[model samples]
Target chain A: MKSKCSRENKRKLENKLFKASSLTLTLISFFTVIMIFTILLVQSKPLIMKKPLSEFLTVEWAPHLGKYGLATFMASTLFTTAIAMAISIPPCILTAIYLAEFSTPKVKEYAKSMIDLLAGIPSVVYGLWGVIFIVPIVRDRVAPPISEALGFIPVFSAQNNSGYSVIASGMVLAIMVTPIIVSVSYEVITYVPFEYREASLALGSTKWEAVKKVVLREAAPGIAAAVVLGFCRAFGETMAVLMVAGCVAKTPTSIFDPCYPLTALIANNYGEMLSIPEWVAALSVAGLILMLIVLVFNVVARIVVIRTAGE
Target chain B: MDKRKIEEKIFKYLMISSTAAIIGTLALIIGSVIVKGAAEVSVNTFINDDVALFPGEEHGILHAIIGSLYLAINSTVISFLISFPVAIYSVEYMKKKSLSPALTISIETLMGVPSIVFGMFGLFVFVLVLTRGFTLLAGTLTLALLELPLMERGIEEVVRMVPVSLKEASYALGATTFETIKNIVLKQALPGIVTVSLISFGRGIGEAAPVMLTAGFNPFPPASLLEPAASLPLAVYTYLSAPGQQGKAYASAFTLTIIVLIISLISRYVSKRFTRYVSR
Candidate 1:
């Protein structure tokens, strides 16, 4: 009787210990984002103190002259991501619609597997492919034709026909993010109730009309969320973009011009900038900016996705 | 009516063609890697460690393959250790707590943070402060942190799917909450846990940005966690920049791709088995 009682007491003690330990672990996990934000802010404080924050946003980025302007990098980042979205959204949405509404089970299965394979490929491999295949295509085939046909437009004219240009980065990013957008949109589209589709068809509407008016309308917000997620991924991407973006610290005047992005700025300089503390801090500030942008977009996207999923 | 018919036909064809184009792009990407990598990937590519510097010199990526597997396994293990506990606490303890929303948001935010930003964090915390330099420990810790939220979310989803009846049954038999979790919840969630682990491992193996920031390059095989290591993705990146190393780069990419392919297939197989078991 004594032994049994002691054993019971030990089990109860173990349970209490388990609860406390796990709660502590949970709290730590919960605070990681805040920790990261604080670390970035503290590390970048030195740079922020030496020079005003506004100076960092100026057009020049020559660290030697103490000029830390990031406008050019910011513009390039935005341009490339915008181009990626413009290129990817149309076909991604169409593919999602096909998989959800049209494809038979076997075909759907195969398509999903293919998408997973695409998603599974590393960024470096994509960069390799971009260098070998996409770069030449853009340099020789895509950019020259566009430049010749649309030279009047500032964005289309080629100042330099280097294969590593904004278009190359955008094209690589579009391919990289396609699987994400497609999968998310497919899920959202499939979640629309079958009854909604049945009712639309019963009204004697054609299949495309039913889909256009009803299904697309219902899944619009979710699709927007998916696109935002893709945008965040493309913006945050470092290696693949770094490898192909030509890393020239200039604001690109044309899609065929080489430009630097914020990610590339951080990645390209981290190793060599160690001797200069101020430069290191400046890079930290760049990282802080990147984190803030991604965090805001990610939160918005998550909220939309959660709300749609809940409904 | 005539216009509507034509519109429907046009859109149907458009959707089909767009999907075909997407698939074709994927095929071309994979086909290019395979075609190019085949020439450079041989048995020596796995056994030898020295990358050929000059013509007719012997070369291999054995160190990178070994390093990648080491980092992925160690990081996944570390992540699983922390994530499993947090997941259990959330599902079992914090389900009704007001902190649930905060936890969810934190996890999602962590998930959405770019890998590059994580690289910055890893550089700050591990490379600069703790490890004092690029080491396997720094790389592993950084990756573990990156994988933490992903593993937690995946595990939590699976644990929540565990039927309440089993827990109640355990409690009825006088099992403690901890015991119930260990024997009943975890047992039921094994396949899902494995699947998530595999996915996280694959992510760790394929990730280059964070690893590049934390894991300094080493040409030789790592002898200890304190030593710098080579990884396949980073190796690919480095080799691509070398004048005559493009062949090595393609081969490294091919090996990494094959590793990821195998992992995904295994995870799919595990999940399929899980669903079948549940149905039966």
Candidate 2:
């Protein structure tokens, strides 16, 4: 009887210990995030305090001239992300629709795996491919014809047609984010109730019409969330963009002109900036800005997803 | 013949073309890597350590390959230790129902934070504040942070899939909650845990930016956790930047691709086997 009582006490103690440890581990997620944010804010304090907000928002980025403006990098980041979204969203949606509605079971299985494989390819591999294949294609094949036909437009007005431009980086970013958007949108589209499709089809609608009107509308919020997620991804992509975006720290005036996104700027210059006064802190500020933008996108996307899921 | 029919046909064609484009792009990337990388593949490329130094000269990435594997395995193990417990707590112990949602959102946000930003965080916290220099340990910890969300999510999904009846049976048998979790939940989720670990390993090996900042690059093999080490992605990035090292870059990319593909295939196979066993 005494031994049985001792065993019970030991079991209870172990259970409590395990529970406490697990709870602590769970809190580490929150702890790590707050720590990262605090560290970035602290590290960037020198730059934030020294430079006026107005100067930081100006278009000039010549740090050598006492101008530590980040407007150029911010503009390029937005421009590339916008261009990437424009090129990628329609195709990604269509692909998602096909995977969810049109493809056969066998086709879906293989195609889904293929997309997963695409997603798993390392960013550096993408960078290498971008440099070797996509760069030349953009310079030799796509740019020349576009420049010839649309040279009157300022966005296509660069005369030299070097492969390293906003368009090249944008295209690469588009490809990188396609699998992410397609997979998420596919999940959302597949979750729509079959009764909606049935009701539309019973009303003399064709298959495409049913999917377009019923399924797509029901999945709209989820698709928007997916696009936002993709945007967050494209905005923060570094190595591939650094490899192909020409690393020019100027606001791009045209799609054909070279520009540097914030990520590319940090990745290329972080190591070298350690010795330069205020440069490391400036880069820390950029990092803080990137984290904030991504956090905002994530929060908005999660709210959209959760609200729709609840409904 | 009607307007509706024309619109439907156009939409169908558009979807088909989009699918074609996605698959075609995948083919183009893999095909180009294979084609260009074939010329540079040789015995020397896999064995020599001076690959980064000589650029276009005779060289290899053996040191980087080994270093990447070492880091990947170590980080994955460390992350699993932390994330597995968090998964169990969120599923089994947390009282407030709202806390789970908040936790999930926070983890997703962490996952979405850019790799370069994580590099900067590591630079400040691990390298600068803690270790006071770039080292393999700092890089491993940074990658562990990066892998935590994915590992936790993977384990949570698998644990949640465990049938309620199993736990009920354990409770009826007079097992303590911790005992039930150890013998019942974890045993059943073993395959899933393995799969998640391997996936994390693959992610760690492929990451470049975080490691580049926290783990100082060295051409020579690392002698200890505090020593600087090279990684496959960093090697590839460096080679791509040098004007004459294009061939070496392609070779390193091909090597990295093969390693990533193998890891992915093994994980897929393990999951497939697990499903088969469960169905049986």
Candidate 3:
């Protein structure tokens, strides 16, 4: 009875209970993250040591010749992602600004709801549209015309029936990522002090000019952070990429040439690759790259947010 | 000069046009998918494995529909079982404790963990290790983890919204903490919980990744707990991407999209109805 009732015992009991839950929570999150990274690391351990992990830096991908290189994949992912970001970020920022600083209440509600609805629409459906609509158009008409018009450009040289071209992939990614950027950028744009706009306008600047010169500069970091979220999402996105990215494992000489994304390799073969450990290795390598890219993107966003907060 | 009048007119038109354009595009997407899906949507699809690729073969989506329902139901049940006790303990009894903040942050962290990463986790650990068991049971458990944080967070919110006055009244009436929770808090939180529950179910139904790994897509009704069953999202994914099934894939996508859209729409309606009630 005394043992059960002891103050020391009660304190110990409470401490144990507390420790149990916190530890459980920690383990759960850590377990999930660690599983993703560790599996990648474990799978890539041999490859990491073999080609000095520098092959991803230097060597061109020659698949049939047994060159397990990532230069092509990385370049393809980065180049088109850059194109997509360039396409999306400006329009997304403009939309956010228009929604936040300009729209009336009814307009704001309607815009936000539409954005939400679009965001909720599955990436697979987006893939179908890209496959059924965009790819054929690009292959049949646009690529050859672009090749003729911009024949000197190294990136538009080869035109294949590779359904989802880099441009198509980039376009789909931009659309997929737009809602996220708009939502976040609009949120940050609204968080800007009304005085920033009012002060600039009072100084004889037109409303648009004030928003451009003052409001845009003030919310630059948040907008950049929003773009980074879009980047992170786009980089890690697998399903739509699998369908729409024209999964040729070659590096693109032109934006018209098809290239497999890091995620597509895994999503395309995650189940069937149990037969081929090489594909497993490839997937794990892709996962590692994906995890690193996303981690860096999120970290960049966080740092920007922190720096902006102090400024 | 009527420069200001022109500016006003331009701004009004721009605002109206932009708003209408955004809604119109989204409406088009939603409407097109429904129409496309409804074209192939049949009672046969819901009740049999009859897959109609083109104008010829009439295969139903019975297997996929059952699999979707089973996975969603199992995940929801598992999440509820795991979350409710922890929720009750945390919201009611553990409110005074120091661990609440830590637990709250943990939940937030889980919420931010990406869905694809969850798929990998399920693949490596649940499907591979603990369960060399890559059956529907494994899939359900994997999804249970996915939905647990969501359900707990929403349930906690609903529970917290219950008034302290009611709790005090129950206490004054000689009710215990457990009694107060059972009698007063739960009933009031029902609508919110129910809505959130539907939302979680909808979310789980749409999850293609973790299910992809844990439940290998077997295109038949699951005969046992260990048997693999095909699901709508997975079917849509494979059929759409896999060679020779592109048409059927589109049909599957249309079907899955309709089901998910309807579920979300209904849940959103429930939330609105509950909000109206709570406001009064």
Candidate 4:
């Protein structure tokens, strides 16, 4: 009776301990989410209520006047991110399709390893390379000719002091986000059943035809979601854009001309956004804008993911 | 033999180029940094400080290196301490299926959060009037905050990969649920959790934003955790951007990159070994 009672007591104590630790972890995870959203909202409130919401729609960012017009920055952020998506998606999808449908096991293994190492490369190193190589090349050679071709626009009509242009930033972002997009798209394509591939081959359709008709069509939503994610990452990115985007606060009418992005603005100024409440107000305002951008992306991404859950 | 073969050849060539592009970029960055930055490595380079306020004298990134490692290790450990328990609770205890999805969403949102936004939160809450000095401790705490979400995500992923069948089998053997998880679930998930931690470790070591504000880039070695000190990332940025120290900055960047690469690689290796051992 004594031994049986002791064993029961041990079981009860163990149960209680396990339950308690599990509860603690679950709470911590929930708390982290609440914390992230709460912080963004709280920090951004100053600009939301006090400042004109339309101020962000303007072309200038004049802090002294309390007008942190994010028109230029928003444009650059969206434009470059859009450009990257455009540049990368076609090739990435093509690569994904080929790998998913056509490539042999040995080749697939080679690509898989390459993709893994690609994801592992850090952003700062990319930033260093960008400044050392990309800026000079764009500024000296590329922009002038592009401007001459599209001479009607006033923005790129005159030569600028630097050529850390919008196109260059876009190019760099495309390169950075390629692996992430390709890998996800590949995963989704391959997840399309072997039956589809076999049916296509048996139907006298070539492998390319099968992938284009069945696999690619099936995985289109997932690919869109992948592109959206890549876009969001490119938009949120700070370090590389900070180094290469020339840190100028101008609006760009031509792709080759540079303008400061929202991320660049926040990164460049936030640490030094001191003394004036207005600067903090502006920080909050920009934060609010960034928050909306991210929220929209997350919602859309969720919708796409849910829509494609089983298909 | 005609158009189709030609198209196939073009497609093959494109795939090859894409693969080369990725492999080439990685090699270029790593190789270039080593070749250029390694040339600037020296004893003084390690010892001297980048005191921009002073004239004609440069200090090595000794203080920053120490500061960074101290903060990164502290923050990583703290984050792991918190996140590992939560991950354990998330997978093992919450076998009640309804609550797990909500937990998963929370984890996903945390990962989606931008680091810049996190910096603002850090500055506003912790750094402002509360922490008077820009110290190593402040940096570590902030880094811990950044690492928390990532660590939880990593651990949770690994824990989930611990099969349900294994859990059932352990219970069938008359082991208590705690014993099953402790011996089987935890053992199985250990590699994955470690992999995630290593990823976070690399990220923390390379972090610049919090350290920019919280650790006020001291040139000399900080006297204690409370004192400000520069880190490798900050030093590289400050040195490279400054007029005369490009070579030193480049070398320091290389050094920091190597440190990050090694930490991540070792953790990954350890995790893999653990996975192999556990499976056996």
Q: Can you list the residue pairs that collide in candidate 3?
A: A155-A254, B45-B61, B50-B59, B50-B60, B51-B59
Give the TM-score (0 to 1) of chain B in model 3: 0.86
Best by DockQ: 1
How would you encode candidate 3's per-residue C-alpha lDDT over A1-311 as one tens digit per residue?
78756965665566456445634644454355445567667766655665566766653554345466776777778867877898777667767877888787887887886787677676777776677666787878778787888868887775574657788888778888888898888877777788888898899876777777888888888888989889887887767666777888777778888878766666666776665555556556767777776776676675566456555
Tens-place lDDT digits, model 4, residues B1-280 = 8676576677777876766666676677678877877887877677665553367555566766777788778889988988887887877777678987787666666666666766666666666645766777777777888788778878877887777888888989887777887788877877777788788878888877656657767777778877777777777667767887687678677877788778756875787577776653
Worst 10 residues of 1 chain B by lDDT: B271-280
Candidate order by lDDT, decreasing, is: 1, 2, 4, 3
Q: Which runs of model 3 end up more than 4 angstroms from their true locations?
A: A1-31, A46-51, A56-67, A199-205, A275-279, A299-311, B1-24, B50-57, B80-114, B148-192, B241-244
Which DockQ values do the candidates obtain, in the order shown?
Answer: 0.80, 0.78, 0.23, 0.45
Each candidate: what lDDT?
Answer: 0.90, 0.87, 0.72, 0.74
lDDT tens digits, residue span A66-107, model 1: 788989999999999999999999999999999999889999
Q: Give the CA lDDT, 0 to 100, for residue B225 in model 1.
A: 93
- The all-Cα superposition gives candidate 2 an RMSD in Å to the true structure of 2.0
Which wins on TM-score, candidate 1 or candidate 4? 1
Q: Against the true structure, whose lDDT is highest?
A: 1
| lDDT score of residue B120 within candidate 2 | 92
Cα lDDT for residue A105, candidate 4:
87
Query: lDDT of candidate 3?
Result: 0.72
**TM-score against truth, every candidate:** 0.97, 0.96, 0.82, 0.91
Q: What is the TM-score of chain B alone in each candidate?
A: 0.95, 0.94, 0.86, 0.87
Per-residue alpha-carbon lDDT of candidate 2 for residues B1-280, written as tens digits (9 for 90 to 100): 9899999889888988998899999989988887888888899888788445665657777778777877888989999999999999998788899999889888888888899988998888889888888899999999999999889999999898888888889999999889999988888888888988888888899999899889978777788999888888988898777787666677888888988899999999999888666521
Candidate 3 per-residue C-alpha lDDT over B226-255 given as tens digits, one digit per residue, 9 for 90 to 100:
888778777878777577755556677787
Model 1 vs truth, CA RMSD: 1.6
